[model samples]
Target: MTVVIGFEGSANKIGIGIIRDGEVLSNPRRTYITPPGQGFLPSETARHHRAVILTVLQEALEQAGLKPADVDCVAYTKGPGMGAPLVTVALVARTVAQLWGKPLLGVNHCIGHIEMGRLITHADNPTVLYVSGGNTQVIAYSERRYRIFGETIDIAVGNCLDRFARVIKISNDPSPGYNIEQMAKKGSQYVELPYTVKGMDVSFSGILSYIEEAAHKMLESGQCTAEDLCFSLQETLFSMLVEITERAMAHCGSQEVLIVGGQLFVIKSCRFFFSNLTIFLFSKSVEFHRFCIDNGAMIAQAGWEMFRSGHVTELPDSWITQR
Candidate 1:
């Protein structure tokens, strides 16, 4: 069996996956998010990664019934992630590759997230909607590169959510997304927030400020309930994303909409609304939350593909992280 190990440490998640042959021996999985209270501290994030990277790797190898030497290749995320966090994972990968003398591939974090669904679902040439703290874009595979049709001009969706949660002082446990999602669920009313869309691209920086202002006013005046504010924020931002994604689909004249990212899993209400889009749009593609977050499985799968396709250098010194 061809065994490949994948590592992903973009943003707040540290993920590892092992795939054998063409099948994921173990589903692409992640350990957990940032610690309680603190959220997205770069130093803390790097430290957490270092603490668990080896443990998770060991668990994955045991689960796959394979040792490090049994790994035919080592694939790890290299870029489009928190630079310090990526270094933590990449160094581990580098060490493994050196010790085992296996082929090491530096995988793009964004591409790995996007490719996760493709690896799990075996879809080809699907339009991918990647939503996360560090990235928000609708990508379509074309030519030799994935084309970005629509993306956030500034501030990603998850980042906006985290900032909003902090503004409201929600517990950062589990995640800002989970905390905010709970708040929205508890919400019973809605308040109006600014809705801005520029062509096919969307902006959330302004939205965050708008929510903060509205939330501030509500807090000072005691006019809007926290539930109302959270609901309103979710409504406005999700609408913007749905609108842009629909527009991109029309522009591409394609039907597939594969979503890849972490926060996508938490926005159940938004996903429900996005489902309504299917009634009007054509041929809704697979939108599985299995690879919802960036993890090792996606990176491993992408790296293995690259290795199989002759897209990577087998030499050890040539494998460089593209942070």
Candidate 2:
């Protein structure tokens, strides 16, 4: 059985996990939360990661009951994330691999989410809707690679939610998306918001701008509550996502639909909304919560797949990408 340790510090979160073949041994993570009305900067996020990463790594090892020598290889997120946070993870992963004399592998953050979702759900050949703090895309496996079928032409869905949360002055204790979801649950009013979908791609910048102005005016005029705006935002944004995802799935002729990144919100919006589509919702399985979101075990699992496929990152070639 192969054992792999993975590091992920691609954004505001820092996580370390170990996987033994198909089973996750341990996954531990910490988030860098900003105060209300503020967003986490890359430099601050990286600093937070550097502060807690080693402690989290030790926790993972302890939880997995494994020593460094027992690990077969080390893996880390390589790209499509904040540069500072990605580099922080890559540097630590490289150091650990060299110290342990283990092979090093670099994983794509998006592929990490996809592989982990597949691992947990066993949904083969599903149309994927990947929505995160920084990424939004509809993807399908084709020609030996996961090709983008549709995506955001501007900011990601999660970013839209986060920016809206800032506009409304919501606390970022757990997450902006989570806060918005909670607020949306109590919302009754459906304020009109712009819904922009350009062919296969969607745009959020316009919606964000429009809502920012509307939120200020409406909240000041006592016309709508913050909850109302939150609910309206979710409805509009998720509808666009569902529309594009449905279109992509139909085009790809896929039966299974896997929701990645903003799992809870997307699942709520897309589940049972698509006629005759097999929706794989990970939220039902409590064990999948960590895997559903950004975590190190996903990175480890992706790296394990790559390593078994004879892929490895040499020391000299290890680098980060912010695609």
Best-performing candidate as measured by TM-score: 2
Tens-place lDDT per residue, model 1, 105-167, is: 888878887777777666666677788877888788878889999888988888898888888
Highest lDDT: which candidate? 2
Query: What TM-score fits each model?
Result: 0.89, 0.93
**Model 1: colliding residue pairs:** 261-292
Kindly report the root-mean-square deviation of model 1 from the true structure over all alpha carbons: 2.7
Off by over 4 Å in 1: 27-38, 264-267, 279-290, 313-323
Error of 1 at 144 (Å): 3.4
User: Where does candidate 2 clash, by residue pair?
Assistant: none
